[model samples]
Target: MATRVLLLMALTLYIFPIATATFHVKGSVYCDTCRAGFETNATFYIRGARVGIQCKERKTMKVAFYSEGVTDSTGTYHIEVENDHRDNICECLLVKSPIKWCSTPDSGRDKSSIVLTHYQNGIVNHLHYANAMGYLRDEPLPECHKLLKYYLADSDV
Candidate 1:
């Protein structure tokens, strides 16, 4: 009985940390140069863009966790979040764009929802990925109309 209790205690000690592991949220930010609402060949990844991770309580919607990060030259930001937020709502949100013309957050692509809990996600590495988000251009590029033709239907093209 004593041996069994010791073994159980050891197991719990080993598993507890893993269960509440820190998660690294990785994602990218881009400038929708064409104002097309989606990435195209003309899309440019924005360097030095500000990004944030926010988690709110599922029931009351009160903020529980928040962290901020900036995009590197490659336009990717890696933000580390501590603890498991299984019952909370988490999102990777856009904060700022460095380019003056591309400062507006894209309407539907402003934020990407993410799951921060390691237990339910089956993510062994504790690495989670949020979808890429983008900022919109003040005006469509001069050649955007021609470039956007490729994305249109046969009749529109």
Candidate 2:
């Protein structure tokens, strides 16, 4: 009986770590220098851009977990969600950017929803990718008007 209990305890320890896995979330931040509402030649990825994850409880809609991250030199921010948040919803939210001139979140393009828990998909080492968020330039670039007209003309057709 002691031997059976000892074997069961050893097996639980080995399987527990494998079952409770972590997921990695990666995304980038950029500067919409042209304010064209999308990326163009004038757009530039921003380094040291502040971003974060906010998880809220589904029932009461209360915030549960929040973690901040800063973009790297290449404008990428990688974060890990260790706890399973299947019962909640999490979003990658834009906080701020180091660029003073371009430091406003574009309306309707600020945050992205991400699934960090294994309940949706039972894959380990899961990688959740978020959309590239950006800040609007203080003033629209002159060339942006011309660029936008091109898109507008195409849409008018």
Candidate 3:
């Protein structure tokens, strides 16, 4: 009888589900180099940039999931995603663009893809952009400013 009771308890524990809370990921958009903000200038034809979220497995270090987002003319963006294990890694990036000069080689232009890691549940503004040469640089400016620093911040869930 005792053996049966132990087995039943073990089974119950194994079958139980674990619960977790959800966190938000938010930020703003900007030119990569100039670190200047992006706005809907005269060139209304220019489409806003796209942002992507990626999750890497802790043990295997492989990408397990991916999601995308679009920036506003004011260069703002917000995304919501499930949190991972404490050891898992999370990142957000800019991907794809439509402008020509902003698409130059040195500008790292190629369709507006920017990658951001280490930041969650806060504002990340204007860290991605196209330089004068027409290439896109999808990274935050190198300043210790709170908003700018988030461009490189990554989180290990």
Q: All candidates: CA RMSD in angstroms?
A: 3.5, 4.7, 13.0
Residue 77, model 1: Cα distance from true site in angstroms: 0.4
Best by TM-score: 1
In model 1, how large is the Cα lDDT of residue 13? 55
Give the Å error, residue 32, model 3: 4.7
Error of 1 at 107 (Å): 0.8
Which run of 10 residues does model 1 get worst, by summed lDDT?
Answer: 12-21
In the range 41-94, model 3's lDDT, one tens digit per residue, is: 211222465667677776898987678776666555566565333455656655
Clashing residue pairs for model 1: none
- Cα lDDT tens digits, model 1, 1-157, are 9999999998775555455568999999999999988999999899999999999999999999999999999999999998888889999999999899999999889999999875544555678889999999998889989888867856643
Candidate 1 global lDDT: 0.90
Model 2 per-residue lDDT tens digits across residues 39-122: 787788999999999999999999998998999999999988777787888999999888889999998667888887765364
TM-score result, candidate 3 = 0.45
Ranking by TM-score: 1, 2, 3
Name the candidate, 1 or 3, with the larger TM-score value: 1
RMSD of 1: 3.5
